[model samples]
Target: MIPTSKPHNPNFSSGPCSKRPGYELTQLDISTLGRSHRSDIGKSALQQAIEQTKSLLKIPADYKVGIVPASDTGAMEMMLWSLLGKKPVDVCYWESFGKGWFSDIKNQLQLSDVNPLTADYGQLPDLTLTNPDHDIVFTWNGTTSGVKVANADWISEQRSGLTICDATSAVFAMPMDWEKLDVTTFSWQKVLGGEGAHGMIILSPAAVERLESYTPPWPLPKIFRLTQNSKLIEGIFTGATINTPSMLCVADYLDALNWITEIGGVDAAIARSENNLAILTNFVNQHEWINFLAERVEQRSNTSVCLRLSLTDKQLKEFGQLLADQQVAYDINSYKDAPSGLRIWCGATVEAANVELLLPWLSWAYESVKNSD
Candidate 1:
């Protein structure tokens, strides 16, 4: 059994991601209880969250933002189902989530005219080979593999194809060039530390045009549908969700967004994640038993920093369990499809001091497990 107490430190785990600074579950707006979400009070709070998200991310005034039914998975599928098949798609895969998209393209959509550009877990597909005329799907950050695209510089500024990004883990933690991204999706459970069950989708002017002009061959469920009566439902982007939402979750997200704005918005959030990553990098550099799963420093994720143990698979598993026994964290393991390792979430809410304190304990756990073996 894992120990119950430590120095009030936390070890990073991927998702449901980190909580806001000084977060307390009991501190939520409990008065939201016994209130209908469709009421004016709830709607007002939800609207504020939507507006705050737009302001904090520096999203352009022309873009539309909406809260969808599912988490990142649902929001992404909604975009794929609604927007894809209008053009030849060039899908990029470098991690498990990307692979999932490939599966959706082949198995679900059954599209035969798609181009898949894939790479090993730690590397990226060659963006140079991507055809600017074909729609491209890529993740801004590979959460499971701890690899990320550094920038949108490779995308052609004059290209016609849509650049859809699954930015679930990257949003708020990184600076996104909104002009370069045609469709962007994220979840409240990620950087904001809000409860799960909702996803946010942002559409560029180009994406809006596609939704209005082109209809997909597949039939869309009412929930997934974005176009209504031959026009895009522009109201949905302004806090009018397709169905009911948890008012409590919306309140939590608003709290998080308020906290984000207070700390200087997205830039400060990125800096906080980068600083947390520096703590881990410094620890990794001095430890022979651990190294970054990302092959290059440039490819490394400032939010999800994956690391592999310099030991056999069995040894790695043992050490992982030992760390758990010490109550350092739960679910530090890598995605099963990737190499054995630990993926640490270093988002804005993760205290830098907590990470610093946890590092020595990780070292101790590794040493203890090795000696026992």
Candidate 2:
């Protein structure tokens, strides 16, 4: 059975992370529970979320922010299917999600000339190799590997190609250079700690033009299509979901966004995340048994902090099992595609104190397991 009490402890899993202050599963006004999402009340709450997101993130006034389907993956596919046919594609892969997109480009789209520039986990592809003439796809943060792009200076502002970014783990946790990103996607369940099933997609003027001027030969699914009646559906960005949405989830997201605003906007939230990461970094440095998975400090992720144990594979497996027995955190193991390690979510919702507590537990787990070995 799932634990009935909230852990008097911190949660460190990467996604579906911890909740913000004043968060309560039973606190929602159930009177609005049964109303149709198309109802004015539902629409108003969603609109508030969009507006709050815009204000908090300092997104430019001209960009369109839409509540799309399938969380980040859905939003990204919508952009990919709708926008990629216009130009040759150049995709950079440094982690699992990037590889997932590459698979989509190869097996799903089956594009003949797609250029995939890949790097091992915990590293970045050479941005200098990216050609401005072709559509560019990359993740702003590699959630699985704990590596993130530090800046967007490498991207040409005047480039003809569209720049698509999967920033699910980066948004709200770090500063994003909106001017450098043509299309960006994020999920509510990430940094915001809201329920999933919805994604926010922001589109620049260039992205809008691509959507209007180009249509893929492939059949467009209703959920993935961003255009209607030969025009981009600007209303979708303002609470008009492509299909129906879970109103409860929408309300939860609004609550999370409001909580973010209360604590100070994106900058404060980013600082909180950075502080959590710093705690882990300091602990990692002092502990000889563990080290960051990211090869360089610059590449380390502020949101998802991945680390590896100082042990051989067989010993590491046993040590991980012991840590699980302690019930400190579940799913701390690295992604199967990534090198073996622990991945900790250091998002805004995670308390710095909780992470600090866990540092000792990690060391205890390491020592106990080593003694057993």
Candidate 3:
């Protein structure tokens, strides 16, 4: 039987996710549209974006937050190129992005003392293997595999090395221990439902110290350079960006941050995402044919909820198309490199009621695909 009701908004691509409920393009302030990014108005808006991000995330005053280019990938590379090579490194990977970082560290950067700690999709690498004396690179949340680190407990507090984390999908939707992380990178396009081409990098004081003291042997591009003559570039954190930022995108991000504030900040955003996950969890519990990609419940991601359905690979493709054809869901297919499954965006921007509505459609799609001749 076809479901009588459908989600009011069906824009659930994992990267751009869904917009906040009641979001309107007309409501965004576009005064700085044609102005130079270096203009006072543009700089002020960028600074506001930075300050509000710090306040909402409760980032320490000593820590630095800066916006950079190429989404989270850019920010992560900047740190990778700038701060590495001073010590032995541990590259932990479970998903595509983490694997990409590992490749860059070993093959691209050609670091001699790099150690790879790896796990297949649906499982977490042995984080316990991380040495306190070596720089550690890992993703806080495996966005493609639906796995996430349960906590920062595996990271040693007294460790001398820096912990670099790619937290693109986990920042707003999950609780992160700032002190446990030395460098964290995310993007506006994830949980916040903002535009792309802009990334955010949060650096602890220790990360800053490393930037000031150690210079990589490679040539630093203008966009990736964080230090000038061994002194940290103070303006980058304060909103003087290395390249021109899209003011229109900045306006959209400001709107998202304001929405975060109105919804009672980070905790509320996290609860909303978790609630969406709970809705899916209940449905998965009722059905035997479906299972989460993440083997451990604690390791599962609340935002990018990847699931394995008891269906053939062709059936999986048809199942996604069936939902998409009905306008019930969009871009809910598994990532290309990941196993054939469904990846739903259960972030804060997605409403729980919509998630509830999406489940019956999943059931209908599965049945429809299975019953096909």
Candidate 3 residue lDDT tens string, 1-373:
9999999988788998788999999999999999998989999999999999999999988999999988999999999999999999999999999999999999989999999999999999889999999999999999999999999999999999999999999999999999999999999999999999999999999999999999899998999999998999999988899999999999999999999999999999999999999999999999998999999999999999999999989999999999999999999999999999999999999999899898899999999898565
TM-score of each: 0.96, 0.95, 0.99
lDDT of 1: 0.86
Candidate 1: where are CA atoms >4 Å away? 1-7, 371-373
Instruction: Name the lDDT of candidate 2.
Output: 0.85
Give the clash count for each candidate.
Answer: 0, 1, 0
Sliding window of 10 residues with minimal summed lDDT for model 1: 1-10
How does residue 123 of candidate 3 score in lDDT?
A: 100
- Measured by C-alpha RMSD in angstroms, how accurate is candidate 3? 0.7
List pairs with backbone clashes in candidate 3: none
TM-score of 2: 0.95
| TM-score winner, 1 or 3 | 3
List lDDT for all candidates, in order. 0.86, 0.85, 0.95
Ranking by lDDT: 3, 1, 2
Task: Give the runs in model 2 whose Cα sits over 4 Å from its true position.
Answer: 1-7, 29-31, 371-373
**lDDT tens digits, residues 242-303, model 2?**
89888888878878887888888899999999998999989887877788888889889999
How does candidate 3 score on lDDT?
Answer: 0.95
Residue 49, model 2, lDDT = 77
